[model samples]
Target: MLTIFLSALALAVQTTPVPPQTTQLPPAIPPVSTPAKPVVEADLRPYVALVTDLGTITVRIETRRAPITATNFLRYVDAKRMDGFQFYRSTKSWGPANQLVQAGNRGDARKNFPPIAHEPTTTTGLTNCKGALSMARLNPGDATSDFFLLLSDIKGFDADAPGGDGAGFAVFGEIVAGADVAEAIFNAPISPTAGEGVMVGQMLEPKVTIKTARRVPAPAEVPQGCVVKAG
Candidate 1:
């Protein structure tokens, strides 16, 4: 009986099934760094002053937000591209006591520099509000040295969506000082049946001359985020 029981126990042990084995996976590799988006300084906002016949209109170029656009504008300035350009057009009646003044080559094909990339509000988060400085572009990425000064807060001009007419204009800075000068240009007389489309009769009869546009350090007295010249 002991021999039979021992033989039965040995048989039961042999009949037990074995569990399936799993291979250990190697440690997962970390993801590669993205290449399209590069790191840029987040706290560098510079200023540039436009000396016009009316007065000096200083704009705070938003380097942190719109680096490409700001750099493009500075390229034109450093190259003395807009020295002789003028505020040639103003669009009034869009808003009461407010308008947009267009300044640049005044349709001079010879004065334009190479067009820069379009920095829409969608990318920069900058809006077409009062005192905003925006590049005047016919189509996206078609803006050269021409820019506009907003006299009123116009949300319609701000970039609401990406591509297909909603990309809007590339606003790089704002009129920190000499808003009075901008207002003067806004109120300047317009020609009857002279301009095309919405710009009809919105052209400044005598364009305000821009004597110079240069980079200047901001004074300690003025606001930090803005730029202005002291008397």
Candidate 2:
């Protein structure tokens, strides 16, 4: 079970004021005296297939709790614009076991679209467990499309800070398949210029490209919750 500290950090990524609905359908008419159902942490069955130079890894994401973040990611996947994007930032020298591996080029000033709000780990009720996929951001409110996959279950990131609620990173998805493939990327030699000070040379292969990120419709009626069952 996820601890309160971990859950609090996950919610940080919950979109503030909530993003305008991504759906095209009209909003549900409010019923007089009917309080809105409290939002629950969602187990989004949204799946992403990352085709990297080494191999492919499939991830099942939870969207119920982090709807905005999930929707934003699906938008990119649907657009088929994730091809050839690179994981420009790799910070392995920090954290336990030098455990972080981040990737997201959808925010490159020249290649990325407009930025999205920061999704702190707190708001989502998720945690930085092993193989967890979290968004990468320079600061709160600047996230675009970059993300990081945890090699080790680092709990230090599971909290909200004053500036961003410590909000750490938003973990919206988990690697359901191809964990070995992810590790291949994590264990790949770190290049000298993968990231700035301390993180430099932390990339497995500085030139390793994500190649493509495709979205496949999840199986129908999958349970929508935050906890991922062991595969």
Candidate 3:
């Protein structure tokens, strides 16, 4: 979202003799087409379980909408690369209440893979609501394996306006179970001077270790649409 690229192409034109006089007609205006809203078919989704020391959190990924983001996360799960990962950062200082526990590789360059494209909420039709799962990226198409869980609704993360951060983080999934566990990690102890800048006091003192992550069956009672209902 923060990056932009421009390319120019040069075309060669040959001069030709013209007749005495000729009439030219103005070009016809092209018709405008409206964009159709994307549907999140439940059948196209896949689920994963984050087995952490706190507890197990089941997540239902919206494969139909955030395919790249969801697939990027599943690659880590299938490769068993998420094992021993830790929720190293907790941004309770972000608001008056503690919300969300940040995890993934925790900034280890070796653990990172190629980043995926930025899928804005406007295009995906997925809101940054409570229990929503989103991809973390430095810029558009820079998201790799790192992600976060929303403990509450935060629509500001969605595309702010025409030129917003490509409509915020790409929400690929949502928590369907283990809300208590996510909350526990969100409220875990933090070091006052650990994280960088404003996130200093928000970093967890003892990072919560992710015991294991594996693919699981999608919940039978999942509500239709791209978002996961907060457990």
Candidate 4:
């Protein structure tokens, strides 16, 4: 009977199934991150205000591109040489679409500075577009204090422009504000028999005086290295 009992216990143990073991997984590694690029700031340009009897016309001078002309203009402003100058010429008769206003010492050699080196549009990459501030000269490198503000895009004044003088006018700055005042000056009265050559009948009878010209604060919102384009 003891042998029979031992045999039954052995049979029961052998018939029971063994439990299966679970396999363990390794931990996942995190991905590597890339570094971000740094932000760059814009380069701001200089601004000047021309307070006129009609209104104020603000301009942004391109010192980087037209250093010679722009510096010359700033010199005059700093010395107060343009304080009593006038916008004496209006080319409205050129056509309703073509217009510009001229301002400076008005041939007052006493108030004039020496002529500056010519900065052609080719070199400066500037154009005589609307609201452009360009130097007026009889020949290359003859520009003095006289300058003009365009009320229209005069591509003919661009260097090497087709059907235009090879040496175009030097554009050093652009009107940023008070273009309306410029337009008003352009539409002002003209003399019937004033001016010479093509300038005849294009002279303003009563010139618009530049009450003051000084460097004003630049707009904070304007980013640095920003290029001012014509509106």
lDDT of 4 by residue, 74-100 (tens): 999999999989999998778856689
Model 3: residues with Cα > 4 Å off, grouped in runs: 1-42, 161-166, 220-231
TM-score of each: 0.73, 0.68, 0.74, 0.80
Cα error, candidate 4, residue 78 (Å): 0.5
Worst 10 residues of 1 by lDDT: 222-231
> Could you give candidate 2's per-residue lDDT for residues 1-231 as a string of tens digits?
469878887787674466676768889988789788999865437788989887887777767766767777777777776777765544556646547667777345566667777665666778777877777777766777787777787666665544534767777787777778877776677666655666666755555688889976664543333333333
Clashes of 1: 0
- Report, for every candidate in turn, its global Cα lDDT versus the true structure: 0.79, 0.69, 0.79, 0.86
Q: Could you say which candidate leads in lDDT? A: 4
lDDT string, candidate 1, 36-92, tens digits: 877774545677888988888888887777888888888878888788888878877
Report each candidate's C-alpha RMSD, comma-separated, in the order given.
12.9, 28.7, 24.2, 5.6
Name the top TM-score candidate: 4
Where does candidate 1 stray beyond 4 Å?
A: 1-43, 161-164, 224-231
Instruction: Tell me the TM-score of model 3.
Output: 0.74
- Cα lDDT tens digits, model 3, 1-231, are 223222221111224445588779899989889898897654757889999988999988888877778888988998888998889887788884436678988646687777777888777777778888988777878887778888888776786544565558788889888878999999899998887776789889899999899998877776544364333
Measured with C-alpha atoms, the lDDT of residue 138 in candidate 2 is 74
The clash numbers for all candidates, in the given order, read: 0, 32, 2, 5
RMSD of 1: 12.9
